[model samples]
Target: MAEAQREKVIRKIEQHLRKTSRQLIKIDTEEQALQYLSDSFRAKLYCDFVGVVFVEDDLFVPKTWSGNVNEVRDTFPLRVDHCSKQLLEHSLTDKEVGLAVDECQLFSLLKKAGVKTWFTVPIKDELHTFGFCMIGFLSYVPLLEMGKHFDEFGQDVAVAISMTRNREMQLKKIEGIEWITKNLSIDAPFEESIEEITTRAGKGTNAEFACIYLYNDYDNCFIYQPPSYGEMKAPKQVRIEHNYILKEHFPFLEKTGGNQMTIPISMDLKTIGVLHVERKRSGVFMDEDLQILRLLSNHIATILENARLYNNEKENRNRLHFLLEYQQALVKETVKHEGFDGIISMLGELFNESVVLFDRFMRPLTYTMDREEEVLIPQLRAEAEKARRKVNPHIVLTEYSQTFSIWPINSGGDLLGYLAVRMSGNELNDYDQIMIEMARNICSIQFIKQKLVLDATEQAKENFISKLLVENVENHESILQYANLFMWDLYNPHRVALLSITLRENELEGCNLLEQQAKKAVVWDYIKVFAVEKTKEILAAMFKEQYLFIVPAEKGVQEFWPQFYKDIQEAGKRSGIHCDILLGVGGKTDNLHDYYASSEQARQALNIVQSRFKEKGYAFFEELGSYTILHQIDNEKTTDLFLENQLGPLEKYSQGKNMDLIHTLRVYLQNNGNAKSTAEELFIHRSSLLYRLEKIESLLESDLSDAEVRFNLLMAFKLYDMRGKMS
Candidate 1:
């Protein structure tokens, strides 16, 4: 009879084992497995209530249940709190399965569920308690005998749940990989890939939100990328100053009152960015979510790598094509047009962007933009210029995405003005940067080409201006035609001003063509009113280390020569021209004949001013008045003969006695023979000056206080001081 009872027990055990295996095989999902276990436990053990609860992020979620499944999952407020965790520990360690309602933290909740007694067995292996299956009864329940099958049933349940979870995770990872592969294209833009990556991550992990914050070493901060999932938005790029604490700056987290999770997206252990997620509950994120996110992150890194490589290769090919086309365009421009205007037009046409060329000194040489943009573009360029000084990249721009990338045009160590491409977007990808850089190279080459042509043009202008000054105008039409070609209104009423510039002796050591051009540019700026392009009246040309400007005279101008001369002197002082600068002006004229006449007059004036020994300043022919007769002589021979004959006696006395007898005689005669004034004029005492005058009188053999003698002595001193330079 005992053996028959034992065999009955063994058969029941075998049947239970076979049923557990069959249930696990039929149920390929964790939820289904949990549901079958709960129902089986209820039927075999005749329990009134049975349920399976899994711990997901500290919440005892009702995965499946035989009784009250809907209420337990939807509204039943029960979780693995600290007290429940303690109870679970006791159940695992002390092998305690049943707990009276008063002794359990879940007493209130269970009472609400209409259960009088409850028993729990931890569904765990050696690693962790994934959850627990709980059984309860409203009537008398057998507790001692129930322990017999409870342990084995719980162990079987744990293994099934573990396998189901692992299988689900594997399936989830596979779906995630497939989703990423399907959504991402290798040749897609980096921004598109970034947007899709964050979206997929959020979906795969079941996160409420997900966004990327790529760290920029240049800005030393993470730049927030807006999630493309909803209406949320962010700056095109923001330089985050805070560490990982972007709460204050990140606007997306402003209304999100929940636990935040930040997973660093890494490639080869180097963190490139971070993925952000949030949940309303503090511990809603589970380990399974982390696993999913980690897998998604791996795929993201690979997608990023593939996208970059594909885009780089495509960009390289496109850039090579653009470069070849750009060089061909440059060659066309060079052969057709030799000025910067053509090159500027070509750049503007190719890029469909504004092109501004500036000298190294920041002076704009040429520009091509819209009428409305003319003012705005320069200001935008100014800001970009500042950024470039800090971060000298091929493409420079602002965070607001107002303008496109600003490229510093450089070639062979020479920096031309920057080339700014007016892209509609904020970031510069490899293709855009390469295109801009290629444009820069083209600009550099054109700049060099334009400079060479300009130099030759300037030399031709100098020759024409020189010829116009001295050559006889036999054919007024020819001269006028030539002047018209140079945009010079020679027929208009104008005057000639010749300027002779001499550099300071100290700065002469390092002087070269560049230095000369620089100095001339500075001086030209100083005399803007007299520069050819600055004023309709002023037309200047460089010739033989000097400048000859033909200034037009209009009605009521009142002879600009005085102001022009004064400006030249001021310019010398401002330019720090320690050496002397001389300017001579001629009277106004209205025809080529008079213009040539004025040019000759200006040349004579320039010669006289430069040849002076005692007087050095501007000499205007109109202001010269009656002194014009003194400059009409062919050479110094006639003036020399007159001055020698007039002062020969005083000159002989001064040489023999080593005294300035002629000067004494001239001073005495000019001061009306007043000894006191003459002595004062010479800064000497009256008595000593009187003795010199007496000696001068002895040498000259002239009567004292004779008006004719005084007149002749005055004339001689004037010629003597003129030093054969009265012309």
Candidate 2:
């Protein structure tokens, strides 16, 4: 009976070992292996408690338990006493060694739970100790007999756990390599690919955080890329000194009891980026984990470098194609001779932006823009002029959040106009700059071409104006024929207006005749263009220092002349020039032969304005009744003699002194020798006027109450004023 019972126990032990081995073989994880070992021990040995205690640091951690002691699983990992740890270490040094339950904290928990007998066997191989397999029984048990079987079972459980872990690690490595290979392509966005790589890296190594940082060559810093799987506590930018992870790089590791690793993503020994992973310090990383990370890093480096080269080539090809297409479109448009407006519209369409063409005066000559962009045209013109003053093409940012790139249309050394583009939400790349430069060159050519035709037309008009002003015409057929060429109605009643511009001392103070003529030529061109644009039917020409225009004698044209004066003054202020502009209008004439008479009258009126030093602005020839006669006299000595005979004494007295006496005499005569009206007009009391009159009478040796003497003095005052203007 004793031999049969022993054989039954041996068969059951073999059956339990075989059952556990089959379950562990099918198991895919470490937790299943541990749980099966605990269940098998409890059922086969009829033990009340079965627990797996794994050594972690200096504590015994109960990983899994079965039977009645499941309630005490959380009670450990308990801090074992020093002697207990020494006993465990010594017992675990050999495969057959057993630990005394009294000295172990794990068994103490089972002892307190009313376990009567308990034993522990080290779950170890020939080379290393894993942990211990502990068993407890509520009733008395034969420990000497079960101790051998417990040790053998512990060995089997250890092998199962190690094999399961190795298998999982190998699977993880294979998955990592497969993921890297599958995602290696330039079709995906660079950021998306990097994010997938980081996520796979984190999962493969079982890391808490994973991140990839790329090196920015311009900023000279490593910019962190967020992972798709988890959040990172690392900073967004880091300045790395080398291609490895330093212990001091992460202070969170020390505080949170974590470990981190990093590997460089490099090309040709130059590190372009780094891959990082971190985990809580429960277990150290294995060689397999590092191997997976290194593989990912190398693959990431290759992808980055290949993507860069591929994208660069693709970009070059696309840019070249874009430029070629633009050139072809422009050439096709040019063949049609579509003018400046057509070119501006084409640019607007090609760039999908607002475009404006401005003349040298910063006036918007043509534009292709929406309503919102039209509202910004004035601002764009202002900025373009500001940039032109800088003498170069550049970018401008306005307060309204608009960006404009202004390119000067320069012919030779002269800036003819500007071509501006509104770049609202994009940066101008190199290809865009090249296209803009090409457009500017095209615009310059177009401007020169137009200027040539305009110059020829202007020369024809200049010849007609010169002959009409100075030549006497006997036959009206020739004059009519010449006027009809410019679509002018020579039979219409028209007025001749002469506009003369004189720069102030600051502009022409030290300039020679050639420099002054050059400046005047620019001003004359501006005036002629302005006149033609303002009134399409007006015939204008620049002759010497004067601008001549034949405008229809209508109410609208009369109103336009005043505004024209204001416009010229505003232009002078804008151009940083202080100038005096005098415009004189002659009488209307219907006959082409009487046009010369109007020109003479206009010239005479202009001469009157020049005679008055303080006078500027427009004057009509009909308004200057006697001044025209005086200016036409053309005898300076006779006027001087008349002034000497009439008020020569007053003139001598006025020298180096106030002209109060002379002014008093002139006022007295203008009031028809009336004292009260003269005093009122002079804003002086009658007695003070009489006192000046008495002094003037004494100096001039004349009688104040004589009408003939007052008349002579009046003519002298008129000549005197005109003489001052001449001087």
Candidate 3:
């Protein structure tokens, strides 16, 4: 009968062991494992009180308990020093069966809680003892009365508990291996793997909440909330410097909150963010549970890292493909399509961003924004300019969450403009830069091709005109026919002003050198429209190096002349050539032959200005008063006189080393007669500058308020600038 009972007990223990093992396998987190152990032990062990106490330092702290367990767990402190020396010694000696029942502090507590018999088992893994599991029976049965049955029951329970733990450890190892294999595969997205990690963690541990907070280096914050969670209940973002989560917040775990067990998730010594798990039930964690969480954490980290790399690689490939296609399309297309609009639309579709292309001046050329009108085009332009000037190319506009890139277009060393693209979405990477360069190359080629075609057509027309005029054999009707052709080709409304510059005889070493230089420097297409409907000598080149060119009057040749002179001077300086310019404005004329007389008068006027202003570097017809008065003004003498009269006192004071006086005068002038403003400007106490000013007024024996006195001082300040004596 006893044998049958023993067999039945063995059968029951085995069944319970299997059930507990299954429960442990379902445990996703440490908290769930604790709860499972507590519940399972209480119901199966037939104990009035069941509790698990984790060893902290040298003391066993109650982590999970049941049936008024909180009362004892809270008040009773189980120190290893105060407990059974026999049991403690046995735990140290025996690696497997660290179970002991003795009269100790825990036993005393059980006695007080109306417990008669108790069994204590050390929950351990391969290495060290993690904690002790206690099962207390309230009955006061004598030791001899139930010795045989007690021994059998106690041994069975210990074996079952140990088996359950072994299974949990084994399962955790399997799960870790499986997760690593699956996550390391190239098919997984980073976010998907992270989600799987967190989800599996939550389910396996039976945690109420499980989250992996990733470190955001850009924001220097933690992103704990997943996208599916519909935004974090916490602020949209939290700074790491302000609200750092520490291990102390988790009371169920040891120092650093199970950090040792969670080393894998913590990333092998680089734990920037936390992987947190919580339970609704109190004391829902065990050392074994922590171990599982730690293992799982490692898998989570690996998966997250892999996923991030995959995402970056994927984005790079996509960007490259988009750029290749866009560039190919640009090269193939010839018509002047909607410049950046089509490009922006294509980029938007390809890169998943609202793109805007701006000109070199920052004006928006084309955009793909939802609210184009609301977009701050000017501000965006300013930002792009500022970024180009002050920051590196890799910088992103964090305030607006936008990125900027610039590309310049040039044809034959002449800058046409720049292409500026503003994109929104992920920050631009190296791949984005490569793609932008590709697009820029395509745009540059197209711009150059179009410019070449236009230049070639204009040159052909110019050549035809030169050939006809040189033959000197065309009749009036033939010349008129060519003029009519020129008028039709140069479509804009135009007027003519003939300019003739007489080169000194033999002064230029090379014949036709000036004309050759002019041909290379001046844009012919721009000049042709200038001579529309004027004279047959629209662009006349005489053998004496005296050239007469008719330019458009209404096309603002007046404004162009100043810049033209500057360009000519620069070109002349570079080529070691010098020539005088004689500009004569002919009245606006519509007929080609009628302006010949006006052109003659302009030539004569240019000669008069050149002869009269022989010593001057530049002589403008408008600057010559009455078109004849050219008086020489000695600028050096004038500068000297002005400096001696106006800046004499300041120079004398500076020579005398009266720095206080010099500073006071400067402040007074800057302040515009306001004592307070002077003091503020000098960063001195108001009384100090005022006192200095009063002393100067007293010493000079002059009323500073007097108009004449102030005027003299102002002139002195002005003269300081002329004399270069301000410093």
Candidate 4:
């Protein structure tokens, strides 16, 4: 049996290498060659089964002949993973065939098949093991000399596997390069295309992980896109200072310990990105893999650079086309209502980018972006405010990224507001700047038209209010008709509130007129709120130096009046406007005639508020319980004569002697004849105050206890204080 087996082994080696070598060369694919060898060697080697494994990838995938694939593959104990320790021990020393039953699980499998011996011949060259072939026999004799004799057959199989694997590797590398370079679309999603290239490169080079790190001119750093099988969220970005061509450490590799290889991806021999691949488990590597990786990196870099250039050319073409179309549309579209609405819409449609239009007050007239729904109101408001503060009328591009460019819009030397162009990629170039400048020029016409319409409407509103306040009430129907024409709710009960703001002379000292105005108006916030109030439902206007608010008198609105007054007065204080404020609230009046009456009374109450109270800045006509009677007497002669008849002698005496009699008499009357309270009020001694009071009585020639005299003297003191400033 030994002699027969020796002869059979010799014959099989000669036939497999010499005769089948020509057939193996004809095989075009690795799978065909593997299957052909496994099936042909089973019967010739006198074995129950045969299996072939080749190292073309990170795995030793076995091609089995003659049984269930899993059952056959599961029995092998010399697989790359199962025999890795033993293989390393024999990496250079042991390369012969083996039939050790105690060392392999295949022994049990062979026993079940009634086989007594099993042989596994490693297919390897001097440098590395390409693959191995395994065979099991029933009742074959164990020969010590056959181990060395099988070396010839093993060498033959190793040569075949090496040729197939090398051919496959070259073809795969070429295909990978071509796929990435020629197949990817210029309009494809840039990040997604990059990820696909990384995945293909990993597969081509037998790497467990792969990544593409591209240069970001905006951040001045490298951004990593990790492999799909890796930590998906990992390496979204990293700040790598050095270029990939130089030896720089990747911070992402610190946590993921592995044997890694990185190649600089270049376009026209200039590195712009990096290609990184790693083996996580055992760092399976080869010279062929590194060579293929280098090729892939070059291909990926060229693809990216070409795609970027193509996209830029396409974008420029689109922009030029849209500019011409927009100019045509702008010239054709006439103003319907709020003439700027159409222009803003055109701006959004043409740009296909983030475009926001703000008025001079930093209030958004209209806005649109790439993803408009994702934008927050505060972000728009903040960006608009920033654009509003820039003094330059040309486009101002921010540093680092070209995503945002702010252009101030002006016409006839008056700044209207700003046009902000924002996007996601490269900064605004000269073409973008020129396009925006033209956009601004075309848009200014609408701005002027809107302004003209606004001015006409404002003039009409002022005319209506002036006529309502000053015209004769005999033609009240004509006045109501005119109010209805301006969309004013004249049928409802309306009351007017006047907010008078005045600045002291010195408050405007260190500031220019424009700066002073800006300070007084609170710049952005106050102007925004005031513009809103004027344009929306509230009927407000800037008349003289006061703000006029004509509003509906709804129920429970009176509760807000106190806080509203405090808010405006606090605004004045904060603005350094030293404002003297007097708010006279009119009573509710139903008819047009009574509306005129209410306004007249409101004016009268405002005129008398200073004379009635000392420190009160506000007065309500309904709450003026005793002062209502005082507000009725408007004749200056009556007031002058009353003051003269009552306190003329005391005034003369006080001026002549510089005594406290007049003051004491006034305090006593205010105190209702209580000397203690009167002295406390005057901050004097009670006995001295009483002496002054008696002296005053002796001069007036009247009893100190007369109720009629007390009443007349109190009225005289109030008139005396309001002598000159009364209106």
Candidate 5:
């Protein structure tokens, strides 16, 4: 009976071993292997408790256990050195005996839980003890009764479990790594790569969650928030700066005790970021698990680096293409034909951003916006000006997902403006920077070219007008003929206003715009808009050199002359453009052929006024003694005497360097007896200019307030200017 019973036990043990072997082979992950050995085979194997304990560097840890596992796990510390030192020491020194505890203590503890006998077998690989497989017997069985057969059977099962678990772990690791490498080689986007890695890692390791953190060098931070989980509430950034993280709040590092594991992702001795995982069960990870995680970390780092490089290369290629297009457009002068708006739009499309072009004064000349303009124009102007003044090559501003990079456009050693490009959610990489530089260069060249063209055209027009004036064909008949020709030739508006010089001597023949000072003043005043309304009319007519016109009045000649004179005087005073005016009145005549006769009469009136008022002041045709006398002074003798008398004091004043007389005369004329404005112009105290004016009044020995005396002094100054020009 005893022998038959023993055979039955042997057959059952064989069946149990066969089933364990089959389950271990089918298991795909470490967690499955652990669960199979602990839960499915425990009771059938005559074990009160089944536990798999992994050993590393003489330390033992209970990875998974059955038979009131929760209670045991909660009661004991997970630390191998402190919790399982006795078992580890016994397993290391004595393989044959295995590790044993006092029957009283072990059996009593088991008996309380409906278990009476206990046995533990050391799990081994190549003669080294990695862990132990433990089983508890429900009925008390004497050691002698179990004998060598029972002990050997237990050892075989433990060894098989350990070997199978290790083999599967290594295979899963290789498969996981291979999958990541294959996916990354295709140059996947960051999000796609991350998703694939995390899913594979989670499934292979039996983890509940997986995450990757990437290093950001610019912000000096780490980004760990994953899209699958939405934005993580945990802080995504860890600043390397001091006082960032307190020691008390440091994250737990033990892999087995906590639900989390953090492994440094490294390549070539450099740590890039961290890979973190969390398991649902407590005390689940072992040393082998950590080894697998470290391997996975290496694979992740390689894949991340490759993805980054691929993105960089792609960006560089796109930027190069954009630069080529920009250069081509600029070289072909397409930018000029398209205008500022077109250029800005092209820039925006090339960079996938909104672009704005500013003028030399930092005013926005053209802008392309992808969205509505929410920011104030003044704010944009202010920011652009600040960037321009600093000459910053790139100024980056981040607000939400948008980033603005402002680049200065420099032309001919002068800052012309800026190019502002707005990028959404991404930083400006090296390729973007290179493209911006190319754009800046192109813009600078185009701007300079346009300015040069404009300047040359203006110069040529001035030269043409100067030639006509110097030929002494600027009278009414000749000017009208030129005006008619200009009206037919030009497309813009045209108007002709006669500007006659009221000389204080018989009229000078060679007086025209050809004189260098007058020509220079005309050009300067044209640029300064000194007489913008008048200049615009002339530019519309001829688009060239300055001119003087003489027009005959048809009616109201008496009333028109004074008003016209006042308008010219005020315009000159307002703009600081110094020029004398003379009006020519003639009887109404519709015949264009009679213009020459009217012009001659006007010249005769101008000559008479120039002689009589050469030292007194300018005179009108109505103020002249008679038309006969005015016509008589067109002789050379009258002009010679007028010049000598009017220019005598100026000659003496110039030779003696007596600015007192010149200043007194200038103030006397400017003040027009007000006394205040003249003093301000001379930068002297008002009382001083007044005293000097009084001295001039005494020297002249005339009532300065008298219209005749004042007129004489003013004419003398005018004659002095005319005589100096002649000399």
Candidate 6:
């Protein structure tokens, strides 16, 4: 080459390099720097094509190009074989090397574009070569002398490009961090914030996709949180271990051969989750990408922690407010004396659930939310028993295709009943629990108040009834006036019933005096309920442990008495109460003043059941044929004198013995002197009865063949049986 031409080429190259340096000084991004580099080289150097190839996965990938290379642009990326390897080696050693179509296969694309030769210059920093800047020529040009001058210029170009790339990368890191920080400052929802963080991290790291997986503490796993923006597909859940890799947890991802970076989102030294980014065929992430992701992960952790705390506080506040409102509503209801019905109505309305009020016996008394028939008393009682046995105050029973949350109503440790809230599902949130608890407490107070009123009213009724039945009060006008106050029209004749109840030992066992008394009250409640159902209209009162019911003298009374007894038995069994019931039905009275006579008849009949009529649960006063006659002879002294005269010696002799001569003689006479019949009735052999008969005759000093003697003995035995049962 001539000296003047060389000087002109050198000056033109120098001028273009100076202008490129000035253009890059104003550039703030890497894309603009690379585009200007290609354009400046192609236009200023008069080259047909200028392409910037970056090292990607050990291949030279053309990232940007200028001028005429569109025909072969799709196949521009070339693998680093021996030919391209030689060119890279020379470029990295600070040599600008030229390539011909025959010299290297990488130059074949330029040849196809009508270029004869192409040469490469390395873009590098002090320690590493990032890529090569390739210039292609369409015509043959001598490059031996030009290559020397361009080599020195290539060093300056490399420095400028490397500096521009680094500056742009730093600016992007700042912008990404600032963008995430600004979004975090906004009061967006937790999910929205998470989406923003993932988006920024993906963009900042230049990754193809990004996503987050939140650590589930309860499940001890990581759950995928799908961002609204991202193309990454991840598993819904993963059982993560310490130092986990995405491909290890999800093996299907391994086939993609992509680069994955997982950064732990941490708060207070605890890893809450992971921020993950993936690079498909784009290649691996750089160290700067990792640093930027770490900062984003930290911010995400902060947002998550804040959201957790905020949501918890908001929930607590809402719960407290709800409880206060519920308590206020209950207090108002109580003040108005609306009782159980109102309380359940409020609960049903507020919770949109069914509510039932049960009596202490677990019987459904009132219900709200149209759930009257659904409240099964038998199931409720069973659940209540379980709760009591388990020492749990509340229990949930799921049966009959429904669920119920039962809160026991107790006052002073005495369980009143239960407030049952029928649940839509089996789970109860803390708010539901709080509301139910408050309802239980309110019901307990109402129960105590109702008990106080009931006790006072019950005491008055008992006093009036006791005067009529036991004291035989004779003030007719005054008695009628008092009866009217109890809604009883005693002007009509009425029959009296006496009840003797013996509770099973287990029901009262391990109970204190008050507890035992409470149990008795519950039994009384059950008896009252059944009695009213049978009689339709009755005036009843409880005294000591017995109940006295006064019903109209209707023909159904006969059936009512028997069925009432049977009903009590069945209910007791179903309600888990084991007991014995002895009932006595008295004859109808003529008037209110004659009620005392009927009551006395009922007493005598009940007495008969306790002693002689042991096989039957109830007895009628009019049905006691012999006992009625004996009881009608009210002169106790005369009956006693006759009893002593007839069988005093026999009774004195049989006092401590298992055999009773008086009973044996009575059975013998009552059976019409047929000893065989008497023996069969007594469950003994005839010889045993004959011997007892001989013994009784010997003791009484009378012959067995006298009808007068036998009659007198029968009378004495009847008195003896009646007297024994009465005592």
C-alpha local distance difference test of each model: 0.65, 0.73, 0.54, 0.63, 0.55, 0.72
lDDT of 2 by residue, 383-500 (tens): 7766676754555655677777777788878778888887754567777888788788777877887888888988887777766765477656666667888988778889988878
Clash numbers, per candidate: 1, 1, 15, 1, 5, 0
Ranking by TM-score: 6, 2, 1, 5, 3, 4
Assess every candidate by TM-score. Answer: 0.54, 0.58, 0.49, 0.46, 0.51, 0.69
Specify the poorest-scoring 10-residue window by lDDT in model 4. Answer: 88-97
lDDT of candidate model 6 versus the reference:
0.72
The CA-based lDDT of model 4 is what? 0.63
- Which one wins by TM-score: 3 or 5? 5
Backbone steric clashes in candidate 5, count: 5
Model 3: per-residue lDDT, tens digit, 1-727? Answer: 9878777776676667567656665655555676777788788866677776766656778777886645567765578777765442222211122244244566556555665566555555444455666666666422223333333333343444565577767877797678668655557655565566666665555555566666677787756646322223333344666555544333343323332222224555676555656552323555556666677766667666666678778877886786777777765553456344565566556555555555433456666656943355566666665664443443355566666555565566655445556555336768767766666665566556656775675555555444433423345565555557556423233333334433445544465876655633343222222332133424433322334444444445556555554553443333223444445443444544334544434443455444443343333333434332212223656656655554445456557564567557766865678988887777889887767777677656667777797776765543443233433
Better of 1 and 5 by TM-score: 1
User: Which structure among the candidates has the greatest TM-score?
Assistant: 6
Model 1 Cα lDDT, one tens digit per residue, 550-629 = 77666233456555566666765654445566777777886666766777677666665765421546776655543465
In candidate 4, clashing pairs total 1
Which residue runs does candidate 4 get wrong by more than 4 Å? 1-328, 331-341, 370-375, 379-432, 435-444, 474-477, 489-492, 504-506, 510-538, 541-546, 553-557, 563-581, 608-617, 641-727
Regarding TM-score, does 3 or 4 come out ahead?
3
Q: Write the per-residue lDDT of candidate 4 for residues 625-664, one digit (tens) a residue.
A: 6455665678989887777767777777777575857667
Give the worst 10-residue stretch by lDDT in candidate 1. 89-98
